[model samples]
Target: MDVSCAFATALDSADNIALAERLGYHRAWVYDTPQQSPDVWMTLALAAERTERIGLGPGVLVPSLRHPMVNAAATATLAALAPGRVAVAFGTGFTGRRAMGYGPIRWSFMESYLRAFRGLLRGDVVEWEGARMRMLHPAGHAPPRPVEVPILVGALGPKGNKVARELGDGLFATLRPPAFMTEHSWVAYLEWGTVLDEGEDTHSEHAREAAGPGWALSLHGAYEFGGPEAVRTLAGGKEWLGVIERSRKQRRHLAVHSGHCVELNAADEAAWYAGGSGTLCEVTLSGTREAIRRKLDDYRARGVTEVVYQPCGPDVQRELERFLEVAKSDES
Candidate 1:
């Protein structure tokens, strides 16, 4: 399986992407949450200038944030910088939009956007809002027509998967949704967390502190996107919903960030069972090296062609190293 690393949109994203490439990762995925991170395209341009050979792209860019023509232009510009090494994935706004107090873009909008986006990438003149548009560039000055960038769709359920297959070259899935594994295209699974070393305490304060944010994001996504039935099945669904409701009512800042990045109220951390003893296996992989290895194998068996390890902790470099160590040993 191809192993990749995803970075939050921070000041050091290009540096981190360079480090991931230097440390033997096959691909580097950068997030697109503008509120918390830098501009995805600008950050990617830096990544392109810093590295060669490693594939680079946004983890999943939100479509509602920009017009289709603008996205096409930005993507084409990035592809011009990196040429054949660029890959992009589009999603119906999640963290980006949620941070702005909006829900996901309508699925119908995403379907239409992906179609026109793909056509533009292929050098076809496409209609947008009743206007015909195409890239205008001089020969040898910009990336040639049909930039050849692979397009992937970020999806969570069956309907999303259908749209992905219908319009995208592949699917960028998170949490190993079963439907994604069975889909007829490339699948990249984004998993969060760190692997514990032999002497490290898997349940220590440091571990819990590192994992809490990812766990919170997972719970938040489940409640917001998974519908009532899915939320009802969560371990502490009732209490979790209460916390979310209160946060929304209070209008608290809900963007995920670098350290202890849980997007919920700090006080209600316990309500969602985000204490040191909570089970984060539902959102992240925090365990011994061997156990993490087994989980990677399980993901591979489940049809995950690429594993995008999204490091969530204070020392992200250390987390990346630990995961790469295990992934390298799997080949041994």
Candidate 2:
């Protein structure tokens, strides 16, 4: 399977994109959490100008965050820079929506957005939100807006996947192969965790710093689905639940996602103190390089066309080098 890297979006993101290009990563997907980082389009535009071949786009675009014309215009600009390398992924805003105490957008709205956005990309004037809209960029201004970038959608369940089949060119999903997937589908599985250093302790401070976000996110997902009882499955889960519970200042969501995807928050760091630390490695791609390689083989065998690995922690360069090294190990 092809391998790609994603950053949680930062000011120095272009430098990391340049590194991913040099290290042979297939793409660089920058996150779109407006509350947690910089503007996704601006960051992507910078990465596009700085690199030559590595693909670039928001990992998943949140429909509620912008107008279709805005998105279609930005895609034109980035497509101008990268040509056939841009991929537009539509998703229900996870942290981006939830931090504001909102939930995922409806699939019906997803269908409408896709129609409007893709039509504008094709230079077709489409009516949206009460008026006709289209990209009017002059020849020198942007790519001729019959810009044909591939579209992907983030979907985990039947409702969402149904929309994906109707709208997107590919599927952006969590680790498992969704039931609808066939060998012909372009499935990109999003994975998390760090490749453990040889002899590194899973519970060590260094390991937590490297892989805590993946484990903590698991806790976050569980708690979102099953509440306090759910997080009790992890080490400090019970206590972490208490911490989040007591902080229900009508905005407990703010605390629940403080360090999402990028690093561990105080509540996240607390949950890794005991035997449960091993769960961090067990649940994610956090194993030795060989272990990760075999795990990747298992995914590729299952017909995953790509593994989009999101590496966390302070040292992005090391994370980038380690993952690419593991992905290319089969050739050696």
Residue pairs that clash (backbone atoms under 3 angstroms), model 2: none
Task: Indicate the residue-level lDDT of 309 in model 2.
Answer: 84
Encode model 2's per-residue lDDT on 1-332: one tens digit a residue. 78998888889988899989998999888888999999999999899889999999888889999999888888888998888889978889877788778888998999999999989989898999899978888989888758999998888788788888888898887744676655237888888888887998788776787778877778788777677787897778886776787785687888899988878777776676645577876678888999898888887777678788887778888887888888888446
In order, the Cα lDDT scores of the candidates are 0.74, 0.83
lDDT of 1: 0.74
Model 2: lDDT of residue 49: 88
TM-score of 2: 0.95
Q: What TM-score quantifies how close candidate 1 is to the native fold? A: 0.89
Q: Write the per-residue lDDT of candidate 1 for residues 97-151, one digit (tens) a residue.
A: 7776777888899998988887887788999899999878678656777777888
Error of 2 at 117 (Å): 0.7
- The residue-level lDDT of candidate 2 at 98 comes to 81
